[model samples]
Target: MATPTPTTDAPFGLDPSGRPLSDKSKVAAGLLGIFLGGLGIGRFYTGHTKIGVLQLVVSVVTLGLGGLWGFIDGIVRLAGSAPTDAQGRVLR
Candidate 1:
């Protein structure tokens, strides 16, 4: 018997560069941002601590209006255009 070789495909769990995908879920992050964006929940879930902290500060300072950034980010993520995670891996 021969061992089947693993294919390096995005849907197969490998990134374009043939690396393992991030453990984070795009939908989960999106939902978190849409609902608790003001709290930077999505950014935190995506492992972007700096962005999460900044988002929190901005949302707090702007009286929550700044949360629009996070909300839009969520939409973008859902649209399949989110950036890489803090560890430079694309979210799975």
Candidate 2:
């Protein structure tokens, strides 16, 4: 007997076992971005560690201007535009 290949159409963020790869929350991320955006905490919460760090650095270098970036990102996330994580996982 031949084994069937797994389908590639699986939803983003689901593991092979049919479970979520990550439990990150979009609302939490948005809130973090609006509240602590200067620190890139939302990016970190969404599993974008590198981006979060870069945001932090940029915010520090630009004298808190980076917070605006985070704020925009947060708004986008809340609006459902930015729903995926760096690993292509969909935020819950």
C-alpha lDDT score of every prediction, in listed order: 0.79, 0.78
Candidate 1 TM-score, true structure as reference: 0.78
lDDT of 2 by residue, 49-74 (tens): 99899889999999998789899888
lDDT of 2: 0.78
**The best candidate in terms of lDDT:** 1
Predicted candidate 1: what Cα RMSD to the true structure? 4.7
lDDT of 1: 0.79
- Local error of candidate 2 at residue 83 (angstroms): 0.7
Where does candidate 1 stray beyond 4 Å?
1-12
The C-alpha stretches of model 2 lying farther than 4 A from their native spots are 1-21
| Steric clash pairs (candidate 1) | none
lDDT of 1 by residue, 1-92 (tens): 45333454433366555565677887898888888888889999989999999999999999989999899888888887545667766777
